[model samples]
Target: MKTETQTTGEQKGFYKLSSLQRIGFGSGDLAQNLIYQTVSMYLLIFYTNVFGISATAAGIMFLVVRVIDVIWDPIVGAFVDKKNPKMGKYRSYLILGGIPLTGFAILCFWNGFSGSLLYAYITYVGLSMIYTLINVPYGALNASLTRDTDEVTKLTSTRMFMANMGGLAVGYGVPILVQYLSPNGKINSPESAQAWFITMTLYAIAGLLLLVFCYTQTKERVVMDVKETENVKVSDLWTAFKHNGPLRILAFFFITAFAMMAIGNAAGSYYMIYNVQAPEMLPYFMALGSLPAFIFMPLVPAIKRAIGKKQLFYVFLTIAILGMIMLYIISVIPALRSQVWLVLVAQFIKSTGIIVATGYMWALVPEVISYGEHATGKRISGIVNALTGIFYKAGMALGGVVPGLVLAYVGFDKDNTITQSAFAEQGILWLVVVIPAILLLVAMFIISKYELDDAVIDKINHEIESRHKN
Candidate 1:
């Protein structure tokens, strides 16, 4: 029933990468997340508090831009598959997209266009599209690096560890930078718009520099030859999706994971100010979210070796859920709301599970790409990344939309920064605990459907390579 190319197991050495190579590759994500996490964590506050937009309007902009990504991602994927630039097939986009991404990312925070919905629409939409141009190709490059299953695992671990390094910087650093830049030392102060602009400009330039570093450090190995490239098409996206089981499972899981992160993160500022009643401790609270990645990500390959991948998911997802329950309990108990120590403890427990679970998921992208190639005789990594990108953006869009709508519905007053109504406080609580907990439960079920264990994936990758040799 199986073709020869669909069933072999050895990758040869073509995909092997050096330590320096892996670190360079990982830096690209580090660079991107520094900018991406900053926007995810602070952009909403900046929109309402500094950029002079209503929450409802900002939420609408988030949804509209993502809808565009749903279409734009496939086009980029198809284009990448069909063409190879002199710089590199995928790496070229890093410069092409990264340059504009830096510009527009800075523009998105500028208040010169304050109150202009049209300006917000253009800047945010441009940022998202260019981001895709960089992200989709970067994702495909992961699969192109090597077909060795274990190599990808190591590569992904290093990548995520570095990605979280960026997360830590943004989590702790943005508030610090903004506060220092603000004359009144309040990031949320309406007069701090100028400060927000200055802060983003510094961050955007750093992201560009990192992107350049990523460009210099890595090279692609396993890729489609001319024959395979000639056959690529936009229609190949649906064709791959319709037939690929692993891609579908990963795509759905991304939707849940990203949405969970987005909602919880967007609620973070409100959560500390309103629920924890410790607005002064906000930077510490946010930084704790990325702290566990340092502790657990380095142990990912060992953990996988010990418990197996599916069991690892089961363990961490359960831990994250328990941590959320603990947080909700701590917040609800009147005596404990001000207990910053207990809140930090709960946050540590929650982030430990979340970092390991979501952090390792990138390693699986190559597996799914190999599966699609084994089935279809085409290594359309670009199209596969595009499909996943669409779902991930959908999740992010919800992250944006849900928070804005929730805040609006609960009567979160933009003018009153010091305190919110009891009901508004509860809405933020739900974002922090209730919503992500439910989504993680769904993610647990979805991941259960992912049947490509390491052994099966290795066979598929080997088989595809065997076919290539013949």
Candidate 2:
């Protein structure tokens, strides 16, 4: 139970977290990815293929859920900032919201109400809304931990690494678990519905345990004072966005980055199952989406040091685009289409770039929050996170909406299980490679507008703390 003051005698607003504290805080992201990653990467496919729904129907549903999130996130953010719960300010939601989040996450994968759009909407909406209760607060928790730029970097690195571990578990392990649990060995069939439910239940319960662990391991060290928090309102979100230049830039980047990742992720199983004509390779392909994080996330601190943050982003984003181009070329070339090793290699390269670029963007969130505090007297961490959440979910909506609509336009038949038409395969290929690469290019440009380098943020954090002292 070593507190920040006891562990590090650093100045106010610059406390350094211990390794355990960092990991404990990070486990929350890991916990979230376990549930949400499964939803993001697999839920659409489960609905269209196994849950007995049209891809277009599922896509429309996804858009509607995000619309709900746009309204809900701001309210949650304002409520969290205004109220000081007895359990903990930000961390308390880790348990309170975590419980229902777990339940809804499990229910989203259940087949009891098979083909019922009403049931799907209720469960998915419940999952998305409850998720905000945890997410907005959890995001604010990062800024509350400490304002030290290096510590935030280390913390973000740990969080991304653990987050990817959760992604890897879902990407690689979900199929394996579903296969084992299924009466038959296939994952994409209606017969595997029971297995999907069982697998999600296990992952969701594990996620809940991790959230509890996160609640215990962390404390809010730096946050808005009570008086400052009292007058917080939803309109402040609009005010913050209007004034916070860096936040606006970062918010746009989140949308593009997440949309790219989401589109690619949503299309991955289809690419492997249909385009690549290798259903057996689905786990391996999806696993590659996250595996690169393990290899490269640890190096982010050093990489950022060697090359500036913007430079790092540009380099990785270009690399991701190149990897996508490679994937496209391989898919088009009759001779290379069957080269599994080449495809995996291309996936690795693409994921490497994506993992680094997107992973580091989170470090920027605290920077923007700090920037907002320096400009305005109040530190509205929840409002800022809620704003970012709105954008992030917007990107997720595109991830859901674009893929399904494209598949439908290309005449993707859920009943056809074995193969889709060439037009449909091309559509899947575009979602997997072309569309995401285009978004990455836009991400690179959007991130270029970001002005808060490490030195600037460190100065802002110092000034904010000085005001508190005065």
Q: By how many angstroms RMSD does model 2 differ from the true structure?
A: 1.8
| Candidate 2: tens digits of C-alpha lDDT, residues 446-467 | 9999989888988888887777
Query: How high is the lDDT of residue 9 in model 2?
Result: 67
- lDDT of predicted model 2: 0.92
Per-residue lDDT of 1-470 in model 1, one digit per residue for the tens?
12222223434523566788888899899989977898899999888887778889888888898899999999999999889898988888888889999999999889997878899899988889889999999999888777777789889998998899888888888888888888888877678888889988988899899899899987777778766688899999999989998899999999999999998988898888777878778888899889998889989999999999999999999999999999999999988877799999999899888999999889888888888888888889899999999999999999999999999999988877788999999999999999999999999999999999988987777676566567
**lDDT of each candidate versus the true structure:** 0.88, 0.92
Model 1 C-alpha lDDT versus the unseen true structure = 0.88
Cα RMSD for candidates in order: 3.0, 1.8
TM-score of model number 1: 0.97
lDDT of 2 at 458: 85
Candidate 2 clashes between residue pairs 3 or more apart in a chain or in different chains: none
lDDT of candidate 1 at residue 79, scale 0 to 100 = 94
